[model samples]
Target: MEGKEQNRQEGIPLQFCKNKTKRRDKSFNVYIKTFGCQMNKYDSEILEGLLKTRGFTLTPHIEYADIALFNTCSVREHAERRVYGQVNMLSPQICSLGKSKRGDNYPNKRIIGVIGCMAQAHKEKIFDRLPQVDLVCGPQNLYNIPDYLEDIAKNNKRILAVDRRERPVDRENFSFRNKRRYLTAYVTIMEGCNNFCSYCIVPFVRGREVSRPPSLIIKEIEVLIKKGAKEVTLLGQNVNSYGRDFNNGYNFIQLLKDIDKMHELRRLRFITSHPKDASDEMFIAMSKLPTVCESLHLPIQSGSDKILKSMNRKYTREDYLRKVDILRKLIPEVSLTTDIIVGFPNETDEDFAETIDIMKRVQFDTAYIFKYSPRPYTQAARLEDNVPKKVKEERHQELLRLQKNITLSNNKKLINRKVGVLVESADEKGDYLIGRSRTDKVVIFKGPKELIGKIVEVRIIDASLANLKGEWIRL
Candidate 1:
């Protein structure tokens, strides 16, 4: 099961926020380092726009940049720790660059900032220990770029713009810069999560779900498609919960049907669906919609009903299998993937076996297995995380080993089959191009650069547990 990004938005920049300075000025280079899900990746794109509008030039190398910003995550403690280590490693280098400037042509002083979920979760604490950090802003305050900078200049060495009480909705006018390199684009349908699962800090850090207007969503998709995007992945913490709180009763399934009805778009996909909200309507739309990918990344965190109850996942083991049943019945060719947490507090041997049993029953095409980690303020943090760290480590490996054979068996069945792949980039051997089939399987094949941005047929000749090796079949 591939774990999907829990919180993010497709960032469009605001022309209204443009600063008076040279474009890509050598004096000011802003480099954004992103970690975590697709949402964070998309947010980096928006961050790029916000910075570009402010006359800051983007830099590929972090060492060369005057502003090193991290759009980070808080799903796992390790994710946050990596950010801390990175900032710590660069603090001295940033200071050195600031001091070593020879003249006006050398460069300006550097500032380190942490934005997005990790910023919301740690707030000033991320800056407290690392005094070199100039700014910390949450996902909702991304549009407050100018003011956050203003405060920093006014004798504020460290400033955090996280509002735990009231989520500041600083909406920006949408204008994308340096578009993602692919026919596929992740267009966010909503921001935040309401689930607040016991072991997760997403809801607290990212806030409740707020969907973009269906019109805005449609407009965004249309723009991406016009910009040579052939496929779109509707990203959200819980995508199936789309339109639940909106005035328009247009649900995720309805959105699929609407998008499918559109001409020119070759493929469509959505991710990280909660098991509960993947309703009959969404499944039905998936079954009927021509462009919707046959793959669904529905996360079933735990298999045992007792463990699920503890995790506050809202679905039992049987309930999850029912979803697979519905999807298989509706679209027999549909590929299924899932996320499994191998160890959670109080999980017994029986619970662990039940999870393995569930895996055997469903035979997910792929699965992402993670050992549970206690996140601060999450409900599970209060519970006794009595599962031994070593035991958790062992269980995680067991799940991974099992999943390897399961995935390989599934891939083996596809050898010599012809599938449509949307070429995104080249494979490990640059001579061949790499793309994903509508079933969301990664396929590699030889093709000209012109083959990109268009769906091409590939004949699978070789198979690996992770991806399919194939050759392009010209139509």
Candidate 2:
């Protein structure tokens, strides 16, 4: 036990299999194709870290990989369809990979695993549909992937692990810190959601809300900052409801306050706040904390009170507006972004008009407009998808047009203004550095390549619906 602890403290990763042969220690490349939100991206990072513990190397090229994993999302029908399409296209290529010198399939055959929410949703059905898949592990059982691969390598049987009872909280030790892009990191403070919004499949697939210990979260952020992370975004299905599961009085506001005390952390952010849980104290924390950005991503799925109630949102249109009013009053320069769903079941022309009215009233900086699609096992799926397809398309387009105009107008207002942008990355051509302002607006500017991870003031020279072009002004 002393030796093992010393090895861990020395940064020497122990293999999952202790009695492994010398052949297993050789580096085997893994390619992960992630299709989903930020949470899924973070999950892929964890998956990569776990695979590394088993002596596996990450490869960017799919053709050279010994194993291929798809971290999927089941949020909408469109997202699922995309995963299927990509899997089919890569099937033959994945199968042809990892041909050993001896030409034996055992221990050397290229492995394909379907992990994450989609794996939980469909389970072993993916194996029946896609015979190429060797493993199907869900979000809850992600920690078992490395062990499952070991078993498959020894014995050629396919593995299916979708257990929901176990919470892999200890997986925090394997948070994959990206050395190349240390400007920002995602720290998932909690997992799962109790609020089963009628249109959402999150609660069903992810299970109930389970918040991580605040001590673990703080330690993770400290490590990230020490490793050159300038910013960290606290992630959860609904971030504002962070510590309700705990007996302690530690809530989202307190969590923010504690994280703000980290002097090395330059910026802080969070996402997907539910309107019902958005509180004055949370807004106040955002205003008081110098590290916290003046931006909020409160998702308002619909503007009509009728649709909101039907979707089990638990917040009326007026309630949402009231919260928005409070937020604006507290953080006058807050950049509000949101998610809007159009053409929900039985939605009338009036209901969609109400959505338009809310958009006009709020003038959000950006809105992710998604057409309503019934997810499997969701309450919305049980109802007759009454809205016509053509009408849904029309309304989706109308919302996009309106939001595009509003976003352009908002950007135009920033012209000639100087904003501090945390440089995130460079354009592919290396002609410009791309970064985001405190408001979370993307700003592209010409600067020294050394400015990749530092915050610099950029003067806004041009504006567009997508991004703002700026000139680096060393003030």
Best by lDDT: 2
After superposition, candidate 1 runs with Cα above 4 Å error:
1-27, 95-109, 150-156, 164-172, 180-182, 427-429
Cα lDDT over the full model 1: 0.77
Q: What is the model-wide C-alpha lDDT for candidate 2?
A: 0.83
Error of 2 at 147 (Å): 1.1
Which portions of model 2 show Cα errors greater than 4 Å?
1-26, 92-109, 168-170, 174-179
Candidate 2's TM-score reads 0.92
Worst 10 residues of 1 by lDDT: 1-10
- The residue pairs found clashing in candidate 2 are none
Candidate 2 clashes: the total is: 0
lDDT of all predictions: 0.77, 0.83
lDDT per residue as tens, model 1, 1-475: 0111111112111111112233333345677899999988888887777667776677888866756888899998778889889988874334223322223332334667888898888775775577666777887777665456544433323556776443243333457434646467888888788888899898987889877777777887787777787898999999888888877677777777888877878889898899988887788888888888899998888889999999889988888888889889999878889988967999999999999999999999999888888998898999888999999999999999999999999998999899988888875667988889989899988888788667888999999987999988877
